[model samples]
Every structure is written in C-alpha cells, then in structure tokens.
Target: MSDEYQTSGEYLHLLSEPAWQALRTPVALALRDAASDATLLDVGAGTGLGTEVLAAAVPDGDVVAVEPSPALRAVLLSRLAARPDLRRRVTVVAGDALGVDLPARLGAVLAMNMIGHLDPDGRRAFLRRVAERLAPGAPLVLNLQPPTEPTPVPFSVFGTVPVGHHTYEGGGSAEPSGPDAVTWRMRYRVLDADGTALREDHADYRWHVIPADALLTELTEAGLTGEVGPLDVVRAVRRT
Candidate 1:
C-alpha cells in the first residue's frame, strides 16, 4: 500500500474545507504537546495539517515533514514558502515514512491518516522503526478512526462547500474488502462559483484494519509502552 496522497492532496488542501477543518484542530490537539522542545517526524504528512500544529507547539524546535506524495509535498512546500518563519521550524521532505533517513532522532512521531494504508507487516515494521528513531520516552502518535467502527460508505456530498474561488462536491464509499482490508472509492469535483467545472478526481484505495490493542501489542514488542488515547489516537512512549 502506497502512502501516496496524490489523488486527494489538491482537493484536501484547497476545497476540502469541511474535512480539513474537522481534522486540523483535533489532530493538532493530539499532537501539539507530544513533541515540545524536540525535532518531530510528521510521517505521512499530507499537506501538513498535523505538521502545522506540531511545528507551532515546538516553537524553537524543528519538524521534518516526511511526505511520500509529490502532489501533497508541493502544497506543503508552498505553505512553507508563504510563511518563512515555518521554514525555521518545519522542513518538508519527500520520502517514505518507513524508509526515510532522519537528520536527528525524533522526540515524537506523528502518523495520521495513513496507518490503514499499510499491511500487517508494514504496520509492525513502522512502529519498530519509529521506536528506533525516537528519543527515549518520546511519544509516537497514530491518529485515525477506531478500528471497531463499521466503515462508512455511500456517503452523500456533505452540503456543497465553498472555499475561496472553488466549490466542492465530494463523497464516497468504503467497503470491507476482507477482515483486515477496506476499499474506499471517493469522487470529488471542483467547480467555479459560476458553475464551470474546474477539475474532478476519483480515488479508489485499499486500507487495512488493525485493532487498537493489536497495534499496541506490536508497539510493546518493539519496546514501546503504548495505549489508545482518549480520542482514539494511539500514544506510545519509547522505552529508555
């Protein structure tokens, strides 16, 4: 499973206002204090929603926003360019979350919206590698919907949303591919206010499901003390 944000990046960054607003605050809340005073690895940092929060929290520290998708990285870089101050705190890079080399050991790891993209082995390996890169007792945050909930599907466009010059109509369906995998089909169309179509994209991807406790066990075996946080975020601390 590729952690590529290519298909959804532009939409999410530009006109997916409702979704972004819903995600930004909570994600930041989950990640804000996790990396205070230390360099952070915002793994799978799609367009930097979570990265922005983490960067702001650690004012003097640094963040290496490791993104695997060129489309997503472009949006993130543009934002960083617009805010010169963020360059001092956040450095966006294109690399695989599991395989990227780091400039420094991380005080925290933020993996959001991409865990389900990995297979079982990749999930376990990712936690292990995160443990290897973290400072002792640093946190590893995995943000997503709880695995126990039934997947959402056939979702209608949630009230047409307008963001800046673009209006978006988007929704999709998620079907269980198997006990561990779910296939999502999303279609989004961007239009100008005058009703001219700007661009449309369709994305179909598969994601695997691993229960929160199962993931915690994997982290524990990798030498981290782990638990599901109050908001369904997985929080683990590396063992010294």
Candidate 2:
C-alpha cells in the first residue's frame, strides 16, 4: 500500500500521457473563472501529473503538490527541475492526505483517484478535514470509484472437512498461461437519489465505493453543498 513503488521514473513516465489527458480539460474548465492570482492544492499528486495540469491552468498562481510517497516525491522533484517556471510556482511536500496541514487557504482542492485507498473511517475523517481547510466557498473536487455489489459464489459441504485440506502447499495455485484465461474486472456506479449518473472521477481508486447519497449527506453535514454532476464526479463547496 506504500506509494514508494510508484516513484519509479519509468512508472511516472508511463503515467504522464494518460494522467494529463484525463485531468487537464475538466480541471482547466473548473478553474477557468477563478482569478489568475488564486492558490491551489493537488492532493496525492503522484509524480506531478495533476500538478502539471493545475500549473497550466493557473500560471500566475501558486500550486502545492502534496504526495505521501517519498519515492514519488523524488520523481516529482526531478521532473520539476527541468521546468524552471513550474519549479518556481510549485512546492513539493511529502505527506499523507489525512495528516498534512495545508500550508495556505486554497481556492481549489483536487483529490483525484485517491479516496478509495483509505479505510472507511479514514475517508470520512479526511472529507471533514478537507471541509475545514477550504476557504469559504472554495471547491473540493474528488474523483473515486463507486462501490459495486459483491457477486456471490455458492458452495456446499455435505460432510465434515479435514483441517489439512485448508493448509497451504508449496505448489500453490496454478497460473493460467494463456490470454484466454478468464479475468474479471469490477464495475461500480455513483448515482444521485434520483438515479442520475455522476461522473467517474479516477482511473484507479483504492477503497470500497462510497454511495452518492452517503457522499451528499456527508458533505451537508460538513457544512458544504454537494452537487453530483453528470460525469460521475462530485463537487462540494463550502457554504458562503
């Protein structure tokens, strides 16, 4: 679960293309109306993918890229070395989303594909903390996978099972050598009370899905107005 493995330059390079493409447009549009002088935070900013996007959007503003993995932070630092303009505007911090104190009041907070990795309690606590840190009317954008119902597999045992049957053997399980081997991918959805589709926010989400209704309720309780947009994304803003 540690982010250390993600710091590889090869890995970071591989991710650059998709991460920029998926986040740039939506994020740019979201910040289009903000003043050029606004400040921003990119949470879980692995390898500066989202940070790069934010940098492009707010050239005259400041960006703080907070990442938990030291390895990834190293890569991010190296990447920033080449772009002097961005290097001046961006500050890289090594810290977890749940523990770090945001350095300044931010105009926008971007949490992309990072929520699900946290345990349930951590997720709720993080959201509440985000509400507290945001400036009045500031927007918090969270992209995560929706939880899906688990599929059940039925099995029956007519007689007592031997204890040795459950013991592991060195041989272990057999591997499928061919591409035809069956592989399953879980799909989830985020829906409002009226069954409207909310945009899917992240390509890789870590934890169990958070229901849309539950999200809205949490936002309301945190003193924010939650809006689930058409793209499976949720935008919550602090009340004015």
Candidate 3:
C-alpha cells in the first residue's frame, strides 16, 4: 500500500467501479480450482471491493484482506461490518503485502493495482514468498497497468460522479521519478451544483514500473510460471 492513498483513498470507488466489475468474472474463473478450505490472500485489498470478489469466488473458503493504509482500512472495516455475509468470510488485516502476517499455505492471491508500491527488489522477494506459499496449481493473479516504464503521463480527468448536491472529480498525472518508477500527482475536487469548486485535495506517491519481460523473468526466478489472461491480467502458478 502507498501512503499516497491516505488522502485520496476516500474517492477510490469513483474510479475503480468499472475495473472491479470487469475483473470479478476473470478473477473468479482463475480461482475456480481452489480448494474448498484454503484461505485466499488478497494483497492491497483497498476498501474491500476485491475482497468481496474473492469471497464470492470461494464460497466455502475464507479471505484475508491486507491493506496498509489506515484510511482505506477504515472504509474496508466499515464495509465488512455492514455486510454480515462478508463479515463471516473476510478478515481485514493491517499491513502491506510484505509485512502482513500471511497464512502458511495460501489457496490464491490477488494483487490488483498495488504492485507498483513495491520496488523491483521488493517485488521479486514478494513473488518468491508467494511462490513458496501458494498451493500447488493455485494462482497468483495481478494486473499490470500502463506506463510500464518510467514515463511521463499528462494530467487528465479520470473520473467524475454526482454525490447529493456536489460532484466529485478525480484526476492524476505521472512523471518519471527513477529508472524504474514514476511519481503520480493526483487531485480530487468537489464541485457545487453550479460547477464551482467547493474543495480540492492533492496527493503524490512513487510507483515502480515493471515491464512484462522483467516481470516474467522475476516470476520464473521465483519458481512460478505466468501467462497473460483476458484484459492482460497475469495468472502465475508455482511450477510443478
């Protein structure tokens, strides 16, 4: 998890709904072979949307949702509390993927939109651990976002939605910050019905970029084999 989400986390749903909807079926289909009792690990489980998807995918199993951002965890906990079914199946844990206390054997793992938080070395180390822990034949599913290299992204409005008498708008831009990373500058704004800006918040965070070849190499070194599925999502499994 990136500290950058502390301020902008509240507005995540406005931008992520479509992605979540599109991901639900693909993720579930990927995990269809999971054991009935295995515990699913959801790294970077922001606000519990992905957690819900995992819980649904494995009706008889449990899900551990790991999120390091307190602000985001607060929302996640609230969502769990409100949904009795999820409350019974999902446990919210507070820590990043590397620091969180994970189960000894995981049925599967989901790392959507959060892999950039880990630098190159960290990602390799994390992959090795996941390879060791994931059940044989189980999958580690993640998505590689754009700007696969350290590249500049021009600012643009990414999302807008109405909320009562106000409209919330979110946008971001990124610039090369290092050989393998970019710094994202994000802005969230609230506008009155008449379109006057009511309030605005800004946040910045570093995102490590991993090219497909590099990621595949790391996966191979970690003892896992990976393939790009629908929507370019990577499904990596430990080699037999």
- Using lDDT as the measure, the top candidate is 3
By descending lDDT, how would the candidates be arranged? 3, 1, 2
RMSD of each: 3.1, 14.8, 1.5
TM-score of each: 0.84, 0.68, 0.95
Model 3 residue 224 CA deviation (Å) reads: 0.8
Clashes of each: 0, 10, 0
Lowest-sum lDDT 10-residue window in model 3: 28-37
lDDT of 3 by residue, 1-240 (tens): 347687898888766776778888887777666655678999999988888877777786888999988888888999899998889888888888788777989888989888899998899889988998889888898888879989999999987889899988999999999999999999999999999999999999899998888888899999999987787688899999
- Best of the two (1, 2) by TM-score: 1
Candidate 2: tens digits of C-alpha lDDT, residues 1-64: 4653442323343434444566567665554433344568888887777787677766777888
Number of the top candidate by TM-score? 3
The lDDT values for all models are 0.74, 0.61, 0.86
> Candidate 3 local accuracy as lDDT?
0.86
Model 3: residues with Cα > 4 Å off, grouped in runs: none
Off by more than 4 A, model 1 = 1-4, 15-29, 32-38, 146-152, 158-160, 164-166, 191-199
Decoy 2 TM-score against native: 0.68
Which pairs of residues collide in model 1?
A: none
